[model samples]
Target: MRRPHRVAVLLVDPVVGFDAAIAPTLFGAAEADGEPLYEVVTCSATGGQVASTNGFALVPQAGPEALDDADTVIVPGTRNAAVRRDGRLDDAVGAAVARIPATARTVSICTGAFVLAAAGLLDGRRATTHWRHADALRALHPAVDVDENVLFVDGGDILTSAGLAAGIDLCLHIIRRDHGGQVANAVARFCVVPPWREGSQAQFIEAPLPHDDSASTAATREWACAHLQEPLTIEQLAAHAGMSTRTFIRRFREETGQPPGVWMRSRRLDRARELLEARTLSIDEVARRSGLGSGANLRHHLRRGLGMSPTSYRKAFADREFTDA
Candidate 1:
C-alpha cells in the first residue's frame, strides 16, 4: 500500500480566511479508491491558538512541530505587516519553517510569498504574489523574479499564488499535478470554479468599458468566436470591428494580455479540445474544424500549449461520461 500524501498548512498570525481554507477543502475532499488521498492538517507557530484577519480565533491540533513530518507545507496570506514591509519573519516562525524537511515542497498563498522570500527559499526562482504587492515583493527580493501576472507560479517544488480567489486556481493546479485532469475536473465541478487557467495569466484583468458608450472590442470578440472554424487574420478582425489593424491589435492586447496570433492559437486549441472530448474525431477532422489547417498543426500547437497529445488528453479527461455514447 502506498502512503497517503501528507499536507500541512501553516496558519500564521492574522491569517487570511480565504487562503487558509483552500488547502483543506481541496486536498481533504479529494479521494483515491475508497480512502482520502491526503492527510491534511493545519498548524500554527505556537501550539495553542491563532487569530484570523477576520477577527475570529481558531486552534490547531498541531504546532510547527507537525511540519517535521509533512510532505508539503503551505503558508497562507497574513495581515501581519512585518512580513510585508521588511520581509521579516518572527524568529520562531523562521525556525519552524526551516525545520520543514529540505525535500518537502513549499507553497505560499498570496502575501505568503513574502514569508517564503524572507526565508530565502524563493531566491532566484520565478514567483508571484498578490498583484498589489508584486512590485514591493520584487523590490525587496531582487533575487526573485516576480511575475505579477498569472494566478499562480508553479516552481515544481515551490509554488505561490496571487491574492484571493487565485489561491483556488493554485490549489486546483496542484491537484492536477498530483493526480490528473480527470480528478482535477471533478474537483472543479464540485467547487464551482473553472478547472484550469494558464498559470501565466494576469491577476486582475480590466474588461472593456461598458457597452452603452463606445465601440469596444466585445463585438469583434463575438465575431471571432462565431467564425473560429475559419482562419482569421488580425486585419480581418480589425475590419470587422471597424478599426485599423494596428489599433485593433493594440486594443486586443490591452483587453487580452496576449497577442492576436497567440490568442487565436489558444482559441483553436480550445475548439480542438472540445471536439476531442465530445466526439471521436480524427486528428485531421479536429484540426480542420478548429481552423488549425492540418493535423500536424494541431499536434504542434496542442503539444506546445497543453503538453499532451489530443488522444491522451481525451483518455485522461474526456473518456468518462462521453464514453457512454
Candidate 2:
C-alpha cells in the first residue's frame, strides 16, 4: 500500500487558532479505499507550547524536525511581532521554516502569508492574505504580488489563502488537485460544507444578501446546474425566476459575486472536470455532457482554465475509489 502523504503544520506564536485547525480537520477526513490519504502533524519552532490569539496555548505534537520529511508544510495566521510589523522572521521561526525540504509544497492561511514572505518563500510569487492586511503585505514585500480580491492564490509550490474560512477553500482545493474531485467532494460532504467554490470568487462581496428577502437566485442556480447540458441564457433563467432579465442578472451577481455568464461557464467547466475524473467517456462525449459543446471547445476551456488537456487531467486523478461514501 502507498503511504499516506505527510503534512506538517507549523504553528507560529500567537497563531489564529481557527486557521491552525483547518488543515488537520479537512486532511484527516480524506481517504481512499478506507485508508487515510494524509498524515497531518502539528509542529512549532521548538516543540514547546505556542500562544494563540484565541486566549489559549497550543502544545504541538512535534518540533521543527517534523518538517524534514514533510510532503507539504503549512503556516497558519499569526500575530508574531517581527513578521507582521517589519517583514522579518523571528530567528527561531526563520530557522524552523528553513528546515522545510526544498521540494515540499508550502502554504499559508490568512496572515500566515506574512511568515512566508518574511522567510522570502513568496518572493516574486503572486499570493494573498486577509483583505484587511493586503496593503501591509504589499508595502512590506513589494516583490510579492498581493491580490486581495480572490479567496486564494495557488502558485504551484507556494500557495496562500485569504482570511479564516478561505482556508477551508484552499485546503479543499489542494485535496482536489492532489487526488480528484471525487475525493475532495467526499471530504466536503463529511464536513458538511459546499463541495466547491471557485477561487476567483470575490473575497469581499459588496452585497452578499438579496435586497428582497422573498426572492433569491439560489433555486435558479440549482436548476441551472441540473441543465448545464443545455445552452442557458439570461432570458431563460429570468423567465424561470419570474423576474425580468435585468433583475435576474443583478440578483445573480449580488448573490454569487459573479455575473451570470461567468458563473455559468465556471459551472460548466466544473461539470467537465467531474466527468473527466470519474468516467471513461470520450473527450467529445464529456464535452457534450458538460455543455462545453464539442471536443475542441472542451479542450480549449480546460487548457485555458487549468493548463491541461482532458486526457492529462484524467490520468492525474482517475481510477481512485472513494471509500468515504
Candidate 3:
C-alpha cells in the first residue's frame, strides 16, 4: 500500500491556537479506503512547548527535523516579533524552515504568511493573511503581492489563507487537488464543514444584515441554485426575492460575501465539475446541464479556473470511488 502523505505543521512562538489546529483537524479527517490519507505531525523550532496567542501552550510532536521528511509544510499564524514586524526570521525559526525539503509544498494560515515572506519563500508570489493585517504585511514585505479581499491564494506550490476559518477552505482545496472532489467532499462531511468555498470568495468582515429579520435572500439563493441550468437574470432573482434589483444585489452580497453574477458563475463552474467527475456525459452535455452554454464556454472557464480541460478533469477523477464512513 502507498504510504500516507506526510504533513509537518510548524508552530512558531505565540501561535494562534486556532490556526495551529486547523491542519490537523482537516487533514486528519481525510481518508481513502478506510485509511488515513495524511500523516500530520505538529512541530516547533525546538520540539518544546510553544506559547499560544490563546493564553496557552502547545507541545509539539517533533522539532525541525520533521520538516526534512514532510511532503508538505504548514506554518500556522504566529506573533513572532521579528518575522511579523521586520520581515525577518530569527535564527531558530530560519534554521527550522531551512530543513523543509526542497520539493515540499509550503502553506500558511492567517498571519503565517509573514513567516513565509520573512524566509523569502513568498517573494514575487501573491499571498494573503488576515485582512486586518494586510497593510502591515505589504509594508513589511514589499516583494510579496498581498491580496486581502480573497479567502486564500493558491500559488501552485505555496498556498496562503486569509484568517481563521479560511484555513479550512485551503486545506479542503489541497485535499481536492491531491485526491479528488469525492475524497475532499467526504472529508468535509466527516468534519461537518462546507464541502467547498471558492478560494476567490471575499473575506467577509463586518458584513451587515437587512434591518427586517424577514428580509433575507436565502430562499432566492436556493431557488437560483436549483435553476442554474437556466439563464438566471438579476431581475428574475430580484422578483423572486420580492425586492428591487439593487436591493437584491445588496442583500445577496451581504449574505454571501459576493455579487450575484460572481456567485452564479462559481456555482455553475462547480456544477460543471461535479458533472465531469461523476458522469460519462459529453462535454457539450455537461456544459449545457451546468449552465455554461457550450463545450467551448465550458472549456474556457475550466481552463481559466482549474488550468485543465473537461476531459482532463474527468479522467483525473473518473476512477476515484472512495467514500467516507
Candidate 4:
C-alpha cells in the first residue's frame, strides 16, 4: 500500500506558540479506513529546546535533518522582530529551509510567510499572512503578491494562511484536497469545525460576534444547507432570518463576506461535489438535488467552477464509495 505522506513542522525561534500546535493537531487527526494518512514530525532549526512566544519552549525530536525526507514542510508564524522588520530569516532557519526538497510542498501559517518570503520561496506567488501583518509583508517583499482578505491562498505547492484559526482552515483544506470531500468532512466532524470554507471567503467579517438580541443569519444558513435542492431566493432567506430583503442582504454580506446569492451558489456547488464523489446519483439527479436546476445547468456550473465535465469528475473522484468512517 501507499506510505503516509511525511510532514515536517519547522519550529523557528520565538515561534507563535499557538500557531506551532495547529498543523500537528490537525494533520495528526486525519485518517482513512482507520489508518493515518500523514506522518507529522516536529523539528527545529537548532534540534533542541526552541523558545517560542508566550513563554513556552518546544522540544522537537529532531532538527533540520527532519526536513530532508519531508514531503511537506510547514513554517509556523514566529514573533522574531528582526525577521519581520528586516525581511531576513536567521542563518540557521534559512539553511534549514534550503534543505527542503524542491518537490516538497511548503506552507506557512500567519506571519510564517515572512520566513518563506525571506527565503525567496514566495517571490511572484500569491500569499497572505495575519491581516495585521499584511502591509509589512508587502513592504518587505514587493515581489510577493499579498492578499490580506482571504482565509488562505493555495499557490499549488506553496500555501499561506491568514492567522491562527485560518491555519486550521488551511490544514483542513489540504486534507480535503488530498482525500476527497468525505474524508475531509469526517475529519472536520472529528475536530468539531466547519466542513467547508472556500479560499475566496473573506478572512474577517464585520459583527462576527452576535448579540443575544440580534437576529442571526447563522440559523438561516444552516437551514439553507438542508434545503439546497429547493430554489432558495434572497427574499425567502430574508424572511426566514426575520428581516427585509435589503436588511438581510446587508447583514448576510457583513456576516459571510459574500452576498446571499453567491454564498448559496457556492454552498450548492460544494454539495454537488460531495454528491459527485460519494453517491451513485446520475448527473440529472445530482443537479436536481444540488439545486443547480438540470444536467445542462450543472454542466455549466461545474465547467466554470471546476473546469471539468461531470463524467470526468465522477470518474476521477469516485474512487472508493465514501462512508463516514
Candidate 5:
C-alpha cells in the first residue's frame, strides 16, 4: 500500500492560535478508504512549547527536523519579531524552512507569508497575507507579488492565504487537489462545510444578512446547482429569486464573489470534472449533463479552466472503472 502523505505544520512563536489549528483540523480530517490520507505532525522551531496569542502555549509533537521528510510543510501565522518587526526570519526558523525538500509543497497561513517572504521563498512569486499586513509585506519584500483581495493564492508548490477562516478554504482546496472531488466532498460533508469555494472568491463581501433565514439568493444558488445540466440564464435565475435582473446580478456577485454567468460556468465545469472522475460517462454525456452543449464545447471550457483535455483529466483523477485498465 502506498504510504500516507506526510504533512508538517511549523508553529512559530507568538502564533495566531486560530491559524495554528486549521491544518491539523482540516488535513487531519481528510480520509480515503476509511483511513487518514495524511499523517499530520505539528512542529516548532525547537521541538518544544511555543508561545501563542492570548497567553497560550503549544507543545509540538516534533521540531523543525520534521520538515526533512514531510511531503508538505505549513507555516501558520505568527507575530514573531523576526519576521514581523525586522522583516527577516530568525536563524532557527530560516534554517528549519531551508530543510524542507525542494519536492515538498509549502503553505503559509495569514502572516506566515512574512516568514516565507523573509526566507526568500516568495521572491518573484504571487502570494498574499492578512489584508492588514499587505502593505507591510510589499514594503518589506518588494520582490514578492502580493494580492490582498482573494482568499488564497495557489502558487503551484507554494500556497498562501489571507487571515483566519481563509485557511479553511485553502486546506479544502489542497484536499481537492490531492484526492479529487468525491473524496474532498466527503471530507467537507463530514466537517459540515461547503465543498467548494473557488480561490478567486473575495476575502471580504460587503452585504450581510441578519440571519441565514433572511431572504437571499442562497436558495436560488442551490436550485441552480441542481439544474446545471439545463440551460440557465441570469433572467431566469433572477425571476426564480423574485428579484429584478439588475438586482439579481448585483446580489449574486456580492453573495458568491462571482458574476451570475461566471458562477454558472464554474458550476458546470465543476460538475463536468466530478462526472469525469466518478462516472463512466462519455465526454459527450459529461458535456451534456454539465450543460456545456456538446463534447466540443466541454473540451473548450475544460481546456480553458483546467488546462487539460477530458481524457487527460480522467487519466489523472478518475476511478479505475472510469479509466481503462
Candidate 6:
C-alpha cells in the first residue's frame, strides 16, 4: 500500500486560532480518486495540550515526537507581541522544529513566520506577513527579505503566506503544485472558494477617495473604461479625474499598490482576458478592443501575466476539453 503523506502542524503555545486551523481545513481535505492523500496531525512542543491566544486550550493528539515522521511541517501564526517583535522561538519549540528531517518541507501561515524566523529557517529567504505588521517583521529579521504584497512566497522547502485566509490560498497552491490544476480546482469547488486568485496580495484600486461627495472614482473610472482603446496615459487619467498628474499619481498608487500606468495596463489585460475567454472575437479584435492595438502585444502580456498564449488561456477558461488541433 502506498503511504499517505504525513503532515505535522507544530502548535506553539498561545497559538492564534485562525492560523492554527487553516492547515487541517485545507490540506487535510485534499484527496485523489477518493483516496486521502495527506494525514495531518497537530503536535505541541511536549506532545500534549497547548494553550491558545484566547482563553481556551487544545489537546494535541501527538507531541513533538510526531515530527520524527513528518513529511511536512507547518507553523501556524501567533499573536504574541514578543514573537512578532523579535522572532524569538522558545527553546523547546525551536528544538522540535530543528528535529524535522532534512527532506521534510516547512511552511508558515501569517505570523507563524515569526516561529520560522526565530528558528533561523527564514534567514536569507523571502517572506511576508499581515501588511500591518510587515515593517516590524522586517525590523526583527532584517536578514529575511519581506515582501508584504504577495499572498505567499514559495522557496522550495520553505513557504510563508500573508495574513489569515492567505494560508488557505497557499495550501491550495501547494496542492496544485504537487498534484495538478484539475485536482486543485476540484478541491476549491468542494470548498466553495475561487478556483484561483491572482496570487499576488496587491490590491486593485481605481482611486483613493471620492472625486467629490457625489461619487468616488466611479465616473472618472467609467470614463477611463470607455476610453481604454485610446492611448490612455497618466496625463489623460489625471485629466479625467480633474486633478493634476502629481496628485493623481500619488493617490492612485496609494490606493492600487501600483502606478496609474501599470493599473491601466492591468485593467486593459483584464478586459483582454475576458475577450479571449469569450472566444467570440478574433485575436486581432481582442487586441484592438482591449487597447493593445495588435495581437502581438496581447500575446506578450498574456504570456507574461498568465503564462500562456491567448489561445491557450481561452481554452483553459472557456473549455476544459478545448483543443487547438
The residue-by-residue lDDT of candidate 6 on 1-325, one tens digit each, is 4577788999888887878888887777777667777799999888878888877888887989899989999989886555766568667787788788889989998888988887778899998776777888888899999988877888889998888888888888887656545666677887888555435636232325645643334456568767888888778777877778887777666554566677678768867876776679999999999998899999999899768999988777545322211
- Writing each residue's lDDT as its tens digit, candidate 3 over 1-325 gives 5678899999999899999999999899988767898999999998899999999999999999999999999999999999988889999999999999999999999999999999899999999999999999999999999999999999989999999999999999999888777788898998888788889888887777577755999888878879999998999999999999998898888877789998999889988988888767899999999999999999999999889999988876754443322
In model 1, what lDDT does residue 251 have?
Answer: 76
Off by over 4 Å in 3: 211-213, 318-325
Lowest lDDT sum, 10 consecutive residues, model 3, at: 316-325
Top of the candidates by TM-score: 4
lDDT of 2 by residue, 1-325 (tens): 6678899999999899999999999999998778899999999998999999999899999999999999999999999999999999878999999999999999999999999999988889999999999999999999999999888999899999999999999999999988888889999999998778888787864455666645898888889999999998899999988889998888777677799998999889989999998768999999999999999999999999999999888876654433222
- Off by more than 4 A, model 6: 80-82, 203-325
lDDT of each: 0.81, 0.91, 0.91, 0.88, 0.88, 0.78
- Cα lDDT tens digits for candidate 1, 68-104: 9999999999876777777878887887788889889
Give the lDDT ranking, best first: 3, 2, 5, 4, 1, 6
Candidate 3's displacement at residue 313, Å, is: 1.5
For each candidate, give its TM-score against the true structure: 0.76, 0.93, 0.91, 0.94, 0.93, 0.66
- Give the higher-TM-score candidate: 2 or 6: 2
lDDT of 5 at 15: 92
A best-first ranking of the candidates according to their TM-score comes to 4, 5, 2, 3, 1, 6
* Alpha-carbon RMSD to native, per candidate: 5.0, 2.6, 2.7, 2.4, 2.5, 6.7
Query: Which is better, 2 or 3, measured by TM-score?
Result: 2
Show where candidate 1 strays beyond 4 Å. Answer: 205-256, 259-264, 267-295, 306-325
lDDT of 4 by residue, 1-325 (tens): 6678899999988899999998898888888778888899999987878898979789987999999999999999998766888999778888898899999999999999999999999999999998888999999999999998998999889999998889988999998877778888888888898988888788783345557535678889999999999998899999898999998998787778899999999988888888988658999999999999999989999899889988888877655333222
Error of 5 at 194 (Å): 1.0
